[model samples]
Target: MEYRKFGDTIVLRLEVGEEIAESLAALCEKEKLELCQVSGLGAAGQITVGVFDTEKKEYFSREYQGDFEIGSLTGNITRKEGKPYLHLHLVFGNPRQNVCVAGHLNRAVISATAELFVRVLPGSVGRRMDDEVGLNLFQFSQDS
Candidate 1:
């Protein structure tokens, strides 16, 4: 992975064999990023995505292997327990099958390369587990 910072934004190049989510989380930790928005595109050989089952409070995930074009990647970075946390979604286009798959991104391994941008926000946001929602919801204030 290689990156350059411009103002509050970071531009990244993820090389082949790199995992999208893992790379981003590591970058966040190294940069000490508290809050940021992420966007990217690339080619992947393996990817896993999931759909959240709100009723069951669970996630259903499926993995795909073979060449796939990353149509879109979007997500956010925040702090959970003072550590970097990432929440991402991915859209994959399988040209061979002429179909697209999209959902909450679990993992993706770059087959070629990926270009990503991170825009750092001014303030920090924290996440806390919400029992009712069965997920971590953002906590805007310390008291909340």
Candidate 2:
């Protein structure tokens, strides 16, 4: 992966065979990012995405293999117990462009390249696991 920081924004180029989520988390750690917004577009050969089942408090995931285009990728970066936390969602289009899927992104291996943009925020943001929702919700403080 290659990246360049420009003011508050960081542009990243993910090479083929790299896992998207893992790479981003590593970058967050290396950069000491406490809060940020993430967005990207890319081509993937393998990916797993899931829908959250609120009633079950679990995710229903499906894996796809073969060429796919990332139509949209959006999420956030925060901290949990002083550790980097990433939450992302994706919209993918099949090679034929006849099928599309959208959900929380679990895994994505770049087939070609992924161009990602991360905008660092001015304050720190934390996450707390909400038992009722079975998901991590952002926590903000006045000083941050």
Candidate 3:
């Protein structure tokens, strides 16, 4: 993976065999990004996404194998409990005509390339597990 830092933004270029989330996480840590917004478009061979089942208090994950177009990857990233916490949603356009799926991003291996737009912010958002919802949600912090 190669990235160019431009002021408060970083343009990430994912190479062959790079997983989107993993690479992004590494970039965030290396760059020391405390708060940021991430968006991108890419193609993937295999991917897993989540569906939070409130009643079950669990995340129901679905995996897809085979090529698909990454429709809209958008999320906010923040340091939570000293770790980079990324919450993103994805919409995939299946290679087969007339098929599409959307869910919370889990894991995706790049097929050819991915272009990411990341804007680094100066702030912090604390996250804690919400037992009833069974998710780590942000509690916005003003201190940078």
Candidate 4:
């Protein structure tokens, strides 16, 4: 993985065999990114995605193997327990099936290359586990 920072924005390049989510987490830690928005596209394989069942408060994930084109990768970075936390969604296009599968990004291995852009925000937002929602939701500050 390679990255360059420009102003408050960062451009990340993921090489073949690299895992997308893992690489981003590493970058977030190394750069100490508190809050940021991310978007990207590329080719990937061995991907797993999940959908949350609100009623059950659980996630159902499915793994896909083979080639896929990353149509979209978007989400945000926040802090959970004072550590960098990532929440991302992905859209994978399978040419062989002529269909696209999308969900909360679980994991993906880069088959070719991926280009991601991260726009860092000034303020930090933390996350708290919402018992009612069963998700780590943003925790905002109340100004005095």
Candidate 5:
């Protein structure tokens, strides 16, 4: 993965064989990104996405192994308790026209390439563990 800052936005190029979510988290950590919004599109050979079962508080995942077009990838990068936190959602279209699957991105490997644009925000969005949900969530300034 390689990226360069273009004013307020950072343009990133993800190479083939790289996993999207993991790479982003590493990048965010390396760059010391406190808060940002990320979006992009790409092609993937393997991917796993999931729908959050709110009632059960678990994710139901689907894995696809083949060429797929990434429609939209959106999420954020923030530091939770001084650690890199990456959250993203992906929408992918299969071979058939108009047939697409979209959900919280679990894992994905770039098939060809992925171009990303991340806009650095002005303030920090930290996270802390939520005992009720057993997960980390956005913690606004006042919560700090």
Candidate 6:
């Protein structure tokens, strides 16, 4: 992966064989990014995505193999116990152009290249597990 920072925004490129979530986590740690917004587009050979079942408080994941074009990738970076935490979603189109899948991102392996942008936000954000929702929700300052 290669990247250049301009002000609070980072422009990055993920090379073939790189895993999307893993790469992003590395970048966040390397740069000490606490709060940010992430977006990207690319191609992948293998990917796994999950759909949250609110009622069950669990995720049902599906894995796809073969070529796909990333139509949209969006998410955020926050801190969980001072460590970088990422929450991402993806929309991808199959090679046949007949289907597109959208869900919370699990894993994605780059097949070609991925162009990504991360915009750092001011102040910090944290996450706390919400028992009622069975998920982590963002925690903001009182002034926010």
Which of 1 and 4 is the better model by TM-score?
1
- Kindly list the per-residue Cα lDDT of model 5 for residues 57-143, writing each as its tens digit: 778998999889999999998877677788899999876766899999999999999999999988788888776785678888754
Ranking by lDDT: 1, 6, 2, 4, 5, 3
Give the TM-score comparing model 3 with the true structure, all chains together: 0.93
TM-score of each: 0.97, 0.95, 0.93, 0.95, 0.90, 0.95
Candidate 3 vs 4: which has more lDDT: 4
CA deviation > 4 Å runs, candidate 2: 142-144
**Model 1 misplacement above 4 A:** none
Q: What local lDDT score does residue 74 receive in model 6, on the 0 to 100 scale?
A: 99
Regions more than 4 Å wrong, model 5: 131-135, 142-144
How would you encode candidate 3's per-residue C-alpha lDDT over 1-144 as one tens digit per residue? 998989989999898789988998898788888888999998988889998888888889999988789988999898777888889888888767779899999998999888899998877786877776788878765541
Return the TM-score for candidate 1, rounded to 2 decimals: 0.97
Measured with C-alpha atoms, the lDDT of residue 129 in candidate 5 is 73
- Model 6 C-alpha lDDT per residue in residues 40-84, reported as the tens digit of each score: 999999999999899999999999999999999999999888788
Residue 20 of model 1, lDDT score: 94
Any idea what lDDT model 4 has?
0.93
lDDT of 4 at 4: 93
Kindly report which residue stretches of model 6 are placed more than 4 angstroms away from their true locations once superposed. 95-97, 141-144
Error of 4 at 103 (Å): 0.1
Per-residue CA lDDT of candidate 4, range 19-121, in tens? Answer: 9889999998998888999999999978999999999999999999999999999999998887888899999988889999999999999999999999999
Worst 10 residues of 6 by lDDT: 135-144
Superposed Cα deviation of residue 72, candidate 2 (Å) = 0.6
Candidate 1, overall lDDT? 0.94
Candidate 5 lDDT trough over 10 residues, lowest sum: 135-144
Cα lDDT listed for each candidate: 0.94, 0.93, 0.86, 0.93, 0.88, 0.94
Expressed as tens digits, the lDDT of each residue in 1-144 for candidate 1 is 999999999999999999998999899989999999999999999999999999999899999999999999999999988988899999999888999999999999999999999999999999989899999999999743
